[model samples]
Target: SMICMNHLKVGHYINFGLARGLGSIAYATTAFSLGLLVDKINPSLLVLFFVVGMVLLLVDLYTIEEIAINSDAKTDTHISVFKFIKTYRFYFVILLGFGITFGASAMLSTYLINIVKSLGGTTSFYGIAVFAMAASELPFMAITHTLLKHFKSEQLFVVAGIMYLVRNLLICLAPNLPILILGMLSQGASYGLFTATITYYVSDHIDRKHEMMGQTMISMMSTGLGSFMGNVMGGLLQDCFGLSIMLIAGLIMTLIGSLILVVFSLKQLKTHAS
Candidate 1:
């Protein structure tokens, strides 16, 4: 993310969102293809593909020009993590909101097959649903740059939060395979928008020298930590109470997270204005 921000400098969000959307498409395609290939061919083939992909990525990384900063530029890199967090407490609060909401969304994604099975969907349908979710992201992500022209990143975050809530609500109420797949399509508005804006928001708010830390914090909180919580809690809830209860719990978390984003985002805007 920091690399993209550094290289692009302008229109970073557009390129970032495009890359992320393309990545999702690649994920869906690779996962589905691998599932089929494993059934027909040796599973060991996966390792070869993984190694090839890594090599290609390494080569690609070498092609990008590195942006150099002035030696005398002011930097906060010397600060302790604790001190940094204390200084950027407001941004941390926003990150918390993202973590909670994305956690709920991640839970849905992680357990999508289970949800599909409950609705009598086959693994093929699961693959189709995944594709739908991934493909749906492209158009929304493509338009995010235009959206940014009319709205602040904080404002976009609130909208994304609302979309996350709605997406979860649809999933919770979905009674059939088609409805469940439809709910997955909401990824366009929810995850797509959020991903498009989040790195941009962090980059804009923090010093350029701290961009790497800010981006890392986002990944840790929203994807690493949040996804871990969601996956674990989702499994436990589904095992203990059942799918309905699990969905309800996710929905509740999404609601709380959305409310947090909305309230705090408005406060943030007001502070900036004053």
Candidate 2:
């Protein structure tokens, strides 16, 4: 088992992340279904079901971690949470990305679920819709991999960011479920491309010793900090400005992300030419 773990490729991290996208889709699908179910189910039964699901999830994670330790021959570092914060400013930016992306995405979630539900989706249908999202990744990922062979990764990152900027702006006022799904689908390119490209870039340019740390840096941005910022900002903005404004606010942030990437990317291109 330990030998198999050591045989894993570096790019497995990206694939591992992709695999978790389905988990997210399923989690959100169940949550939305449960939300819709609250009106239909007895309150006590609903609460009992919720508690059982959470407990099972915790148990599952614990079991998995035990297996990981056994198979991977690694131990947890008992580092203080605050020490991670004290590490660097880029990590803070990573955190900011997590918070903003999650916050904004959450604001859109209710709207998205409602849109799908409106478009003849039942609870079971919601699961299918979520599955569709999870499934869309494979094709887009293949195209991204092909593009990587022909283009500088920074350029592709900027391209993905641009597509997201356009997709979300239009999504804010999407007139139907089809359009909403189209916008949501941009995540396939936006998050997917930026992440895969960043991972490859870091692994290719950095020394083998630091590659893992560089990926950890990306994980901090994409999941750790990005999730916090996205969820929080989405909630606050939705509370303050309503759904339309909340969507627009998020659209603006993605646009800014694109702009920042463009600026840095152009500089890199110029440096390479010289």
The prediction achieving the highest TM-score against the true structure is 1
RMSD, one per candidate, in order: 2.1, 6.5
Largest lDDT belongs to which candidate?
Answer: 1
**TM-score of every model versus the real structure:** 0.92, 0.63
**Candidate 1, position 147, lDDT:** 85
The whole-model C-alpha lDDT of candidate 2 against the native structure comes to 0.57
Model 2 TM-score (2 dp): 0.63
lDDT of 1 by residue, 54-94 (tens): 99999998987777544355554666667768978877888
Off by over 4 Å in 2: 1-103, 114-129
lDDT per residue (tens digit) for residues 157-257 in model 2: 56765766765665676776667667766766666566556655654554444345555666666566655666667777657876566667777776666
Give lDDT: candidate 1, residue 13: 33
